[model samples]
Target: MRNLTQTVTRWAPTGTDAAGDPIGYTRTEILGRWEESQQLFTRSDGTEAVSRAIVYLASDVAVGDFLLQGSSVSASPPSTAWRVEAFRKVENLRGTDSERRAML
Candidate 1:
Protein backbone atom coordinates (compact mmCIF):
# COMPACT_ATOMS: atom_id res chain seq x y z
CA MET A 1 0.00 0.00 0.00
CA ARG A 2 1.09 3.58 -0.63
CA ASN A 3 2.09 5.67 2.39
CA LEU A 4 1.94 9.38 3.19
CA THR A 5 2.74 11.80 5.98
CA GLN A 6 -0.01 12.93 8.36
CA THR A 7 -0.08 15.97 10.60
CA VAL A 8 -2.41 17.29 13.28
CA THR A 9 -3.58 20.81 12.48
CA ARG A 10 -6.39 21.55 14.98
CA TRP A 11 -8.01 19.92 17.98
CA ALA A 12 -10.87 21.58 19.84
CA PRO A 13 -14.08 20.78 21.73
CA THR A 14 -17.73 21.15 20.80
CA GLY A 15 -21.09 21.57 22.57
CA THR A 16 -21.67 22.89 26.12
CA ASP A 17 -22.86 21.63 29.46
CA ALA A 18 -25.72 22.99 31.59
CA ALA A 19 -23.16 25.24 33.29
CA GLY A 20 -22.53 26.84 29.89
CA ASP A 21 -19.11 25.23 29.71
CA PRO A 22 -17.94 23.33 26.64
CA ILE A 23 -19.00 19.76 27.03
CA GLY A 24 -16.04 18.47 25.05
CA TYR A 25 -13.36 19.40 22.55
CA THR A 26 -13.13 18.69 18.84
CA ARG A 27 -9.88 17.88 17.05
CA THR A 28 -8.93 18.22 13.38
CA GLU A 29 -5.79 16.37 12.38
CA ILE A 30 -4.22 16.68 8.93
CA LEU A 31 -2.10 14.08 7.19
CA GLY A 32 0.00 14.37 4.03
CA ARG A 33 2.99 16.14 2.55
CA TRP A 34 3.17 19.75 1.52
CA GLU A 35 2.16 20.41 -2.13
CA GLU A 36 0.29 17.12 -2.30
CA SER A 37 -3.17 15.83 -1.52
CA GLN A 38 -3.71 15.70 2.26
CA GLN A 39 -6.14 13.73 4.38
CA LEU A 40 -8.03 15.09 7.38
CA PHE A 41 -9.34 13.40 10.49
CA THR A 42 -11.81 15.13 12.81
CA ARG A 43 -12.60 13.96 16.33
CA SER A 44 -14.61 15.43 19.19
CA ASP A 45 -14.83 14.88 22.93
CA GLY A 46 -18.07 15.76 24.72
CA THR A 47 -21.51 14.43 25.56
CA GLU A 48 -21.63 13.25 21.97
CA ALA A 49 -18.14 12.48 20.74
CA VAL A 50 -17.38 11.88 17.06
CA SER A 51 -14.53 11.56 14.53
CA ARG A 52 -13.89 10.88 10.82
CA ALA A 53 -11.14 10.47 8.20
CA ILE A 54 -11.15 12.21 4.83
CA VAL A 55 -8.98 11.83 1.72
CA TYR A 56 -8.14 14.77 -0.53
CA LEU A 57 -6.70 14.31 -3.99
CA ALA A 58 -5.08 17.44 -5.33
CA SER A 59 -4.40 18.17 -8.98
CA ASP A 60 -0.69 18.07 -8.22
CA VAL A 61 -0.91 14.70 -6.60
CA ALA A 62 -1.31 11.29 -8.22
CA VAL A 63 -4.09 8.87 -7.39
CA GLY A 64 -1.69 6.55 -5.57
CA ASP A 65 -0.31 9.48 -3.56
CA PHE A 66 -3.64 10.12 -1.90
CA LEU A 67 -3.57 8.77 1.66
CA LEU A 68 -6.28 8.87 4.35
CA GLN A 69 -5.57 9.67 7.97
CA GLY A 70 -7.27 8.16 11.01
CA SER A 71 -7.75 9.55 14.55
CA SER A 72 -8.87 8.58 18.07
CA VAL A 73 -9.67 10.43 21.31
CA SER A 74 -9.14 9.54 24.97
CA ALA A 75 -11.20 11.15 27.71
CA SER A 76 -10.92 11.16 31.49
CA PRO A 77 -14.53 10.04 31.91
CA PRO A 78 -14.93 6.51 30.62
CA SER A 79 -18.64 7.00 29.93
CA THR A 80 -18.00 9.52 27.15
CA ALA A 81 -18.68 8.13 23.67
CA TRP A 82 -16.43 8.69 20.66
CA ARG A 83 -17.88 9.01 17.18
CA VAL A 84 -16.61 9.65 13.63
CA GLU A 85 -17.19 13.06 12.10
CA ALA A 86 -15.96 13.15 8.45
CA PHE A 87 -13.05 12.09 6.28
CA ARG A 88 -11.33 14.52 3.89
CA LYS A 89 -8.00 15.80 2.66
CA VAL A 90 -6.54 18.98 4.14
CA GLU A 91 -2.84 19.36 3.36
CA ASN A 92 0.18 17.92 1.59
CA LEU A 93 3.87 17.46 2.40
CA ARG A 94 6.98 16.51 0.37
CA GLY A 95 9.48 13.69 -0.16
CA THR A 96 8.96 10.12 -1.33
CA ASP A 97 6.31 7.84 0.15
CA SER A 98 8.85 6.15 2.43
CA GLU A 99 10.30 9.44 3.57
CA ARG A 100 7.06 11.40 3.95
CA ARG A 101 5.16 8.48 5.42
CA ALA A 102 7.81 7.88 8.07
CA MET A 103 6.75 9.29 11.44
CA LEU A 104 9.45 10.70 13.58
Candidate 2:
Protein backbone atom coordinates (compact mmCIF):
# COMPACT_ATOMS: atom_id res chain seq x y z
CA MET A 1 0.00 0.00 0.00
CA ARG A 2 2.76 2.42 -0.80
CA ASN A 3 1.03 5.72 -1.49
CA LEU A 4 3.31 8.52 -0.46
CA THR A 5 6.67 9.98 -1.39
CA GLN A 6 8.82 11.73 1.21
CA THR A 7 12.37 12.81 1.81
CA VAL A 8 14.59 10.93 4.26
CA THR A 9 17.64 12.69 5.57
CA ARG A 10 20.36 10.86 7.46
CA TRP A 11 23.49 12.09 9.11
CA ALA A 12 26.50 10.94 7.14
CA PRO A 13 29.76 11.04 8.97
CA THR A 14 32.20 12.41 6.46
CA GLY A 15 35.01 12.81 8.95
CA THR A 16 35.81 13.77 12.50
CA ASP A 17 36.61 17.27 13.68
CA ALA A 18 39.61 18.30 15.76
CA ALA A 19 37.71 17.22 18.87
CA GLY A 20 36.72 13.95 17.20
CA ASP A 21 33.09 14.95 16.79
CA PRO A 22 31.08 13.61 13.90
CA ILE A 23 29.35 16.06 11.55
CA GLY A 24 27.41 16.54 8.32
CA TYR A 25 24.37 14.87 6.76
CA THR A 26 22.93 14.44 3.27
CA ARG A 27 19.28 14.27 2.34
CA THR A 28 17.78 11.30 0.50
CA GLU A 29 14.54 11.12 -1.38
CA ILE A 30 12.44 7.99 -0.89
CA LEU A 31 8.96 7.06 -1.91
CA GLY A 32 6.91 5.37 0.77
CA ARG A 33 3.49 4.99 2.33
CA TRP A 34 2.92 7.69 4.92
CA GLU A 35 0.24 7.35 7.52
CA GLU A 36 -0.61 9.34 10.61
CA SER A 37 -0.85 7.06 13.61
CA GLN A 38 -0.71 7.04 17.36
CA GLN A 39 1.36 4.09 18.55
CA LEU A 40 3.66 3.48 21.46
CA PHE A 41 6.90 1.60 20.88
CA THR A 42 10.17 0.89 22.61
CA ARG A 43 13.18 2.42 21.00
CA SER A 44 16.44 0.60 20.24
CA ASP A 45 17.96 2.35 23.24
CA GLY A 46 15.27 0.82 25.46
CA THR A 47 13.42 4.11 25.86
CA GLU A 48 9.69 4.55 25.48
CA ALA A 49 8.55 6.63 22.52
CA VAL A 50 5.23 7.59 20.98
CA SER A 51 4.98 7.58 17.22
CA ARG A 52 2.82 10.20 15.57
CA ALA A 53 3.44 8.98 12.02
CA ILE A 54 4.63 5.91 10.20
CA VAL A 55 6.30 5.44 6.85
CA TYR A 56 6.58 2.18 4.96
CA LEU A 57 9.27 1.86 2.34
CA ALA A 58 11.58 -0.62 0.63
CA SER A 59 14.73 1.16 1.74
CA ASP A 60 16.13 1.11 5.26
CA VAL A 61 16.32 4.18 7.47
CA ALA A 62 18.02 4.64 10.78
CA VAL A 63 16.19 5.65 13.96
CA GLY A 64 17.55 9.19 14.01
CA ASP A 65 16.90 9.98 10.39
CA PHE A 66 14.47 12.75 9.42
CA LEU A 67 11.32 12.25 7.35
CA LEU A 68 9.71 15.03 5.36
CA GLN A 69 5.97 14.96 4.67
CA GLY A 70 6.28 15.32 0.90
CA SER A 71 8.71 14.79 -1.94
CA SER A 72 10.65 17.99 -1.30
CA VAL A 73 14.19 18.36 -2.61
CA SER A 74 15.38 21.84 -1.77
CA ALA A 75 18.70 23.51 -1.16
CA SER A 76 17.61 24.24 2.39
CA PRO A 77 15.99 21.59 4.54
CA PRO A 78 12.42 21.89 5.69
CA SER A 79 11.60 23.39 9.06
CA THR A 80 9.14 20.70 9.98
CA ALA A 81 11.29 17.59 10.30
CA TRP A 82 9.96 14.39 11.75
CA ARG A 83 12.60 12.39 13.48
CA VAL A 84 12.40 8.63 13.17
CA GLU A 85 11.90 7.16 16.59
CA ALA A 86 11.90 3.46 15.67
CA PHE A 87 12.49 1.31 12.62
CA ARG A 88 11.89 -2.35 11.72
CA LYS A 89 11.74 -4.54 8.68
CA VAL A 90 8.67 -6.55 7.86
CA GLU A 91 8.66 -9.83 6.01
CA ASN A 92 6.16 -11.23 3.59
CA LEU A 93 4.19 -14.43 4.19
CA ARG A 94 6.91 -16.27 2.30
CA GLY A 95 9.50 -15.03 4.82
CA THR A 96 11.22 -12.67 2.42
CA ASP A 97 12.01 -9.09 3.24
CA SER A 98 9.13 -7.05 1.93
CA GLU A 99 9.25 -3.56 3.37
CA ARG A 100 10.70 -1.45 6.14
CA ARG A 101 8.50 0.47 8.53
CA ALA A 102 9.66 3.60 10.32
CA MET A 103 7.94 5.32 13.21
CA LEU A 104 8.27 9.07 13.39
Candidate achieving the largest lDDT? 2
Candidate 1 — which residues are off by over 4 angstroms?
Answer: 1-6, 31-72, 75-104
Residue clash pairs of candidate 2: none
How many collisions per candidate?
22, 0
Q: Give the per-residue Cα lDDT of candidate 2 at 12.
A: 31
Residue-wise C-alpha lDDT for candidate 1, range 1-104, written one tens digit per residue = 13335442333446667877657654444554423233333232223322223332122221112122344443321232222243233343553322212111
- Per-residue lDDT of candidate 2, residues 27-53 (tens digit): 667768778998898899899988898
Native-vs-model 1 lDDT? 0.33
Q: Tell me, by TM-score, which candidate is best.
A: 2
Query: What TM-scores do the predictions have?
Result: 0.22, 0.74
Residue 76 C-alpha lDDT in model 1: 21
- lDDT on C-alpha atoms for all candidate structures: 0.33, 0.71
Q: Model 2 — which ten-residue stretch has the worst lDDT?
A: 4-13
